[model samples]
Target: MIKHHEPLETAGPTVGAGAPAAGTAEAAPQDESEHGTLQKLKVMQFNIWLGGSEVEGGRAGIADTVATVEPDVVMLSESSPERVTNLLADLAERGLTYFDNKNPDDRAVLSRYPIIEHTSFPSWSKAVFSFGGTEIAAYSGHLEYRYYVTYLPRGYGGGTPPPLETSEYGWKKIPTGPITDADLIMRLNEASGRTKVTQTVLADAAEERSAGRLTLLAGDFNEPSHQDWDHRTQDLFDHHGTNVTWSTTKAIEDAGFCDSYREINPDPVLTPGFTWPSDNPGADISKLTWAPDADERDRIDFVFYYPDERLRLHDSLLVGPSGSIVRSKRVQEPGKDRFWCPTWTWPTDHKVVLSTFHIATR
Candidate 1:
């Protein structure tokens, strides 16, 4: 699910490695004492599939989606440096100027506003920028893909190598029934290092919030949320009738971050917000699915924000193909959950999460 690429073309000004981008220093300062200034801010969480190289015209599709949505900030996963370069150029041609720190990691932050400061970690990155006098700190992450224990409950291998019965090299079906032990599932999920990495992000985000910055975190977590897996729908989505309090999302919630998508769309049964195994018209079904015989659809991708008096969640929606790969077939999801389908070609096997907020700035 990870890929490397050679640098393509560069478009707008990009910051050098380990340094802040150039635009923020030039931004005019707005007095913090002013009040009643509210601006609509839209943030998008996207995983450009293998840097948008898995399908033809996929990179262009990424640019098109950003241009169409016009999000103020984009937390990008699987964004190779090459893909980021090419995407900036593509967006520039479309008359939209976006800036990236030229992150060397797979996860990167792209912003329509000036990137005042940034820091990058092993699996994630953060960008601090100002929007109408309200400082915002945004963290984007793409967690480890190995030891995806959710698949174990679906009667499939979870990409962890042997020694364990549920461990297998690739996406292979096991001859056993669903593993319904909640503790075992949590242990395997912990081994993936998602919880550890998320804790690091939360610690840093806490500092930012203490400094009075509105904080937003979004990513392709590669794990289900604790909120989604209660007694309500554990039997559905191949949970095998077991309820799991997935540790990663639980940590974020415990740290006082609101799951933005789930906040607006509360009912998991009606608006599941499944983000993975999206039906890509340009790619084959085999490439899209990990478990061929299971309803592996899950709401793994997410957007979380530390609630503040300055921030109000307006709306959030999944942006991608309406149909998803269910049991290895493209099936249209039926419910109140509707996607903001792209007018251009849809890219990636993960649907993008776009959330709108009204940020009050002085």
Candidate 2:
């Protein structure tokens, strides 16, 4: 069954206070190794809405939510300096310190262990650190979103004209209703092009993998994956005239990365992990300057990795709210391992994906 980590209104005590010192760059104790033979790590992928600046409890809620997970590594998108500062301070107060961060104001990586090496791009960043004497590459990424194509006029935002004007929310002008097949094709092509940046980043990380090392890719792709939206689940999305093959995530998968959430919940029809429109108060896109259609949300955020024989997927935790009903039937079902349902407070519009892995390092 999928593990759902409940949201904490406040930071709790340090998770692994008695475990190995993070200063020594060793892997933390393995909770899954009942036989006490494996080492494990927890990674969290979160897109704190604009750094969770607009949340009711502000960055504190974001910090508290993250602290509750006690992740060894965190990949945050839409992060800001102020929010990161507040989050770090809150974690410190909880006796959980993450000393390393990249691009503290945007796509960033936070690690409790030391970041031995790091790399960056315009839209993504990666850090290579030691875990159980093996090098591990952890990437934080954020891809170009669909607003360029759907919210702005054609050629205005470097995106193609969308097929259907399903939602009149856009720039200065109202969109024409129910687009044509040709328009849909245009949108698909434009969307695919936007993913090239993320593809390159993932490819680079894949190539950098070496012996005694593993690679992890996590963050907000801002677009759904071709794997997630196939012929079977095309109806779930508004369709926008045609089932588009989202390229950003496809590229990562092509490079041999596994979507951590999907790896556990293989049936897309059953476990549709939607992480957008967080459906929160401040997350309403209608209030933005160029309001786009937040009506049809998708699972844009992810935690992906290069699967290794040495690594075992223990459990994936989805942290979000239970309400905010979507129109899809498959997503609304509530049961064990049925999509995601949260009983606690979700601070940001984007829910968090935390994947715990047990690595056999002997």
Scored by CA lDDT, what does every candidate get? 0.81, 0.61
Measured by TM-score, how close is model 2 to the native structure? Answer: 0.77
Per-residue C-alpha lDDT of model 2 across residues 1-362, encoded as one tens digit per residue: 01233333211122222221222236656554433446768788888777656655646666666655667889988886666787787777756678555564478888877888887876788888776665688889877654444322221232333453422343333334433243544455455455667766766776777544788889887666666656667555454434556666776788888888888767666666666655554444343223243234557788988888767777664666533334311133242332233333456777678787887654
List runs of model 1 lying over 4 Å from the truth: 1-34, 162-165, 168-170
TM-score of each: 0.89, 0.77
Candidate 1 at residue 113, lDDT? Answer: 76
lDDT of 1 at 24: 23
Give the Å error, residue 22, model 2. Answer: 15
Q: Please write out the lDDT profile of model 1 over residues 50-159, one tens digit for every residue.
A: 87789887887888777766678899998888888888888788776888866788899998878998999868899998887789999999999988888888988788
lDDT of 1: 0.81
Pairs clashing within candidate 1: 34-362
